[model samples]
Target: MTRRPRVLPLEAPLHEAARIMRDEGIGDVLVTLGGRLCGLVTDRDIVIRGVAERRDAAHTTLGEVCSAALVTVGPDDDLGTAARLMRDQAVRRLPVVDAERRPVGIVSIGDLARVDGLGPGVLAGICQAPPNV
Candidate 1:
């Protein structure tokens, strides 16, 4: 529920964005401008939109396929409320946003699974946190 998240700038190359995602071991990246959430890009977008479409990662910008239709929620919103919104909307990720539309941490189905009040092992496969914690 932090109010500041790691973000990729609009001009970053698609490949670089994907690299960062992989390096961070996260599935999505929040795009920002002037410190506010502007878009969201996921692994699926890269493979489907970028690769399937034959986009040149070297030349393609994150802004090209980044979904400006960011489904976001306030930090104060409960985990259950956030999970329901994601499920009902058929989205895998949500960008936590502030009143000014600034991105906070992201919550994916994985993160939600952790908060679903399930027992420990219930999330071992879902959240994909670093191993051997």
Candidate 2:
């Protein structure tokens, strides 16, 4: 899991979120509302929901573009469980949280492959996939 995952306030502009992703070399950012996890915004979300949809990104907030239905994993979760969750949810990344649901880190399929030896094909597919829809 990647500790200290990037987070953005719900009101943050899409342009700023995109900037963060570019600078951080990440595909997504966790969206927070009042210091609580609320949603996730990805590069694909920016394009499909922001640009292609013709929304003014400078004025649009992360909350408007982010996905609220989150599929997270606990820090103690086994790799198999985590993998299953990813497959079931069709998500490439999973936020690792504490009991309080505070995000402590993030795990991507690539990370799983590196650490747990998930299949290379799975890792490649996830790495090649467009950011979370």
Candidate 3:
């Protein structure tokens, strides 16, 4: 898991999130409200939801485009549980939170890939294409 994951307030603008992602070399930022995890905004969310939708990045807030229905894992959860959550949710990353639901870290598919035996199978499941809408 990546400790000290980047975070931003829900009211932060999309451009600010994009700048942080670029400067920090990260793909996503955890969105918070009242210091609690609320959503996630990925680079893809910026381009697809913000740019493609013609929303002004400077005016659009993270909460406007972030994935709010989160699927998080607790710090005490096992790697298998994390992997299973990612596979089932089709998400590339999961925020690792504590008892109060404050984000402690993030677990990604790449992090699972480094494990001895869990990588390939979980990755395969995550990579399977979604059916046409």
Candidate 4:
């Protein structure tokens, strides 16, 4: 797993985060503090909360819309488990954290796809064979 994902501080204005996301071609940012994972922000947050509320993105801090209920996984977690979490939660991104909840990296559907050689209807990695007795 790649370490130190591009992060945005919760104190940063929502607009700044949006700019970074667009510039980086990523849809989400890990909200971090002192190198620890705290929360997360996404483009959906920008549109659903910031624009819908008519809040000034330039002045609105990520703390306003960052989902503090962060669902995370460890770097050692298998990609399948992460996929299950995404499907169960209907979330597109997940913060890869250590046992102490410190941010190690970030994972997204894009990342997972990259892992499995995504192409022509490929889903994810086939890590194990079917059980046979």
Q: Rank the candidates by TM-score, best first.
A: 3, 2, 1, 4
Q: List the residue pairs that clash in candidate 3.
A: none
Whole-model lDDT per candidate: 0.80, 0.86, 0.90, 0.79
Q: Model 4 scores what on Cα lDDT?
A: 0.79
lDDT of 4 by residue, 20-51 (tens): 87876666788877767888888898899899
TM-score versus the correct structure, for each prediction: 0.85, 0.85, 0.87, 0.79
List CA RMSD, all candidates: 2.8, 3.7, 5.6, 8.4
The local distance difference test score of model 2 is 0.86
Q: What are the runs in model 4 whose C-alpha is more than 4 Å off?
A: 1-3, 117-133
lDDT of candidate 1 over 109-131, digit per residue (tens): 77666654556565646465573
Error of 1 at 70 (Å): 1.7
| Number of clashes recorded per candidate | 0, 0, 0, 0
Q: Candidate 2 has which clashing residue pairs, if any? A: none
Please tell me which model should have the higher lDDT, number 1 or number 2. Answer: 2
Question: For residue 60, what is the lDDT in candidate 1?
Answer: 95
| Model with the higher TM-score, candidate 2 or 3 | 3
Better of 2 and 4 by lDDT: 2
